[model samples]
Target chain A: MGEKKFAIIGCQHNHIEIFIEQMYQLGYSCAGIFEEHDRTLAAVIAEKYEIPLVENKLSLLGETIEIVGCASMNHEKIDVIELCEQYGKSIMVDKPAVVNQDGLARLEVIIERNRIKVGMLLTERFHPAIYTLKQYINQGKLGELVHIGMRKPHKLNASSRPAWFFNKEQCGGILIDLLIHDYDLLRWFTGKEIKSSAGLVGKSVLPEHPTFYNTVNVQVELDDGLLTQLYADWHTPSKSWTWGDGRIFVTGTKGFAELRLSGDPLLGSSTPIMLYASEEEEWSKVDLIQPHATITADFLSFIKGEASLLTHEELIKASRAVLDADAAVLYKLIPSSKESEPHV
Target chain B: MGEKKFAIIGCQHNHIEIFIEQMYQLGYSCAGIFEEHDRTLAAVIAEKYEIPLVENKLSLLGETIEIVGCASMNHEKIDVIELCEQYGKSIMVDKPAVVNQDGLARLEVIIERNRIKVGMLLTERFHPAIYTLKQYINQGKLGELVHIGMRKPHKLNASSRPAWFFNKEQCGGILIDLLIHDYDLLRWFTGKEIKSSAGLVGKSVLPEHPTFYNTVNVQVELDDGLLTQLYADWHTPSKSWTWGDGRIFVTGTKGFAELRLSGDPLLGSSTPIMLYASEEEEWSKVDLIQPHATITADFLSFIKGEASLLTHEELIKASRAVLDADAAVLYKLIPSSKESEPHV
Candidate 1:
């Protein structure tokens, strides 16, 4: 098969660097880059990588690139969606595909009309620990799924990004930006749909941020008797670059497993995954899997028609669930709006 | 000094049994027992111990009891408060002293007029691990406190508790009943007043209970830079009376510590407490201190004027903070009533 050509649509996302490295590693030819406006790091990185920086999104359509990765800021998602539909290109957008329902519906309608393949960058689905977890559940190793608890707490840079990034209207606050990662993962792992969700979003710290909430706690009821609780925040003040403290704990009728990604920066540290069973007296270490690389590889394989998407409809459902949670928060924050009423 | 006498009021609270045992251990004589219209477990226990079970609140006034311990369910708090005030007795009510602001205000007024000591049974304040956590902060062992996280997840019996215990207006949901324990502890440890709080409450699993929410998540900002998040739930299927699957994690500028308590009876067969620290490479065994006994001992000494109440005003403030969070949830849950307007 001819080597697939790849291009990036935006430069405001944290995962752009990782995406670029993955593309090169996978032997995909770097076609070009597109940025809506000039930015220092985007320009410098594009120049350093010897890739063309297209001034307009339409210019990418003229290039022979087959896959466009949307790594734009949360507010700029609508523009990326428009470009993808215009070019009839298969695309993958970073998490929190769109902040509000209107933007999400617009994206959905465009994709439906274009009949193009669309994927969400829900890397948690590809996490080695999570993959292993899914394998165990499928094998009935943990017995009937009873309860799921997940936490994704990370520290965000105070200086980076535009001021609008902190606004609720722009990003849908922490529930979408931070907690949605787990919301999607919870739905993926439990194999259950969220019946109803209630959440709390408020400014616990960082009052300088424009949003009313910096932390969120959400309880989601699955179709089965399983209950999932998700706690997420961006208020931790650690200075580490790769500070993703993600933990997924599942309790079954027979046994339970707790998976955690180390927050410490010290590489070569072997303690990452842990599993415990009712038959055992201690938590045994499980072999770690590379989630980020797996996600990239899986997306490429899906593009090549080798494997079906690991999570597609689940992603949409998860996104909608997160939006519902955000609506709950907004209802609490701004009671004046009738649109914030609970759907259930 | 004359011997101090105490009366037991109600018995719906979980800690009542422990309180009675601790009172015996601390050598306090029961003056009487009071239950408004029904005979409760507290009255039965009181009668078994050869204490009088008074049927009328007015009769307690002539009994000369120095203190009244109100461990009634939410609906009975107002009558408990009035009876305590009428008898000119110092009072100690369970956490979430009242569900509504009007009831809370009335209790505050009665306490002010009677000029009597009032306390809330914030048993966490006397927890050895929590006390050690407080000492760590006071000694500046972990540098400036930055973030606090707590989890109080438990699996309760499906058929326990009265219907009113689940009602939003009656029990104030899980935020008040469960999360308030951590709220009081956070205020005590950080010595910071809660600036504001937002929370989510729902009955994700146990729909059988009609009155109260089964799950809750709350985030609060202290006056200091410290941020606190608490998760409380009552829907886990596993049932163990003497244990809980909960963890409290406190992070400081320099270090972090994690204390996990599991209700699995099997763990207690070998070790009582599991403690871990960032400085340590593995979880270690730690001695568990009985908080109920410690609190009862402290109260006995405090009543004798030998020691001060360990958690008094701080408990009240925590209860108020949690009540505010419950109000936040109710505002989100119910349709917009005239009371839904933000008073702050």
Candidate 2:
């Protein structure tokens, strides 16, 4: 296939460097980079790669780009989506796609009216070890799925975030920002609709950001009697960054498989994905797949109609699960103020 | 003090065998074993140990035992407390000492009136590796405490117990049954009161018991701004007689430590404690201490007046924290019933 041309929108995210590198490696030609403002890292990266940085989103509408990669951090996703829709370009947006149901629905309607290809950035699902694990499960290597547990413990630098990132109304807190991956994976592995879920969300150490929840734990029940538990937080101290780890564990009637992505400094900057299987009787260290590359490839394939990418329906469903979990934390599942009062 | 004599009350818990071996090893003479009704295993163990089987609670009270180890799985701890009060004997009671607030209050009144020594069997607090970690923190080895995460996953046999055990009113579900260890440890390590907590609790696969929450995930806020997350479940399948694996990860400003405790053969267990220090150059394996032995030693030391045991005030506070968390789960922190809907 001929190389596809892509433009970048909302270059305020941490993964922009990885995205640009992956796009280049995948033989995709960059058309231009567009941001609401100039002199951002996104613009710098674009300039470093010798790509034109377009200042206005509207200017990219008539460009030769076939796709736009939306890499904006939280709260700016809605604007990115609207611009992508206006250009009628296939787009890949980072999670969470939007902060609330209203924003999510608005974006959904826009994408539907334009018939533009839309994909949510859930790069973890494309991790090479995760892909292999999915293949193993599909081959019935783990028997009938029984239970799944996932932990994503990330330490966010309190000093580094855009102030809006910590506002509940802006980012939807950690449940949405961090746990969207869990919600998607629960559906992906169990193949069961979520029957019910409850979550606990609140500020941990970041008293400076009282409106947002920095820590959250969610318990979800699936349609087929599978139970999934997820714990996500941004409260670990700075010194423990080396031990920052992400794990996915799936257990079945026959055996289980565990995939751990370690952030230990000894392992270096590149996180190795290690997979342990009952059948294999040993844990095999697997090479890491550049998630951004896989995601870009998948998006391109979907746009070419060569393969079906994660559909908007799936993204909406996953988004709703995360939104519902957050709502459960904020309104329904958490105790009322009066109820929280100590009795004695 | 001369060799102390002890009697077992309610010899029905799964840990009764371990208690028996521990008592023997600790140089305590078995006054007798007592249960409401006789079971072959209990009778056999008592007989094998050359300890007579007492007929009832009255016989246990009437014995010359200086200590009573209430190992009953039942939550009717008030009766045991009353017996210990009447006999002026010290006691170690298996936890969830009383299932409800009223029962707990009554036990408290009786213990206060009798002025007898008591120990709540919180063996997890005394777990060797956990104690070592505590020591490191107490000595400022880990620097400023930041965040703590713990998980306990287990499988219970359907034929194992009476139906009442699954009832929240009776056994207090997974929160009190499993996560209490974590709750206690959090308070122990932080020396801070739990200001607030929220939890998600629900039944997943154990359809036989719909009312009981087989899984729980709790996020607790401490007065010191420490965030702690705990997960507990009793629905994973077991391959052998052993079930459950536990992990505790503590992250501090200076370093971090991760502890894993494995379950029995039919149940999964955790790996031994692994300690990682950023200041130090290596990851080291720490020794595991026998928890029950430590509990026994603590009780003995308290009885000898060499050290003060965990006070009633501490026990009540810890129990209150656990119960409050459970209540949060039951009430659904948010007011909307729809938000409490399960996803699975």
- The prediction achieving the highest lDDT against the true structure is 2
Candidate 2 local lDDT, residue A331: 24
**Quality class of the docking in candidate 2, CAPRI style:** incorrect
Q: On a 0 to 100 scale, what is the lDDT of residue A125 in model 2?
A: 76
DockQ of 2: 0.15
Query: Who wins the DockQ comparison?
Result: 2
Tell me how large the interface RMSD of candidate 2 is.
Answer: 8.8
Q: Write the per-residue lDDT of candidate 2 for residues A104-177, one digit (tens) a residue.
A: 88877975785787777787677776766776677786767655777776767766666667777766677888
Note the chain A TM-score of all models in turn.
Answer: 0.86, 0.86
> In candidate 2, how many Å is residue B207 off?
5.5
Residue-level lDDT of model 1, residues A182-295, one tens digit each, is: 777777676666666665554434546535454556666566434466766563435333354566777665556767665222223434664544323344455554544456
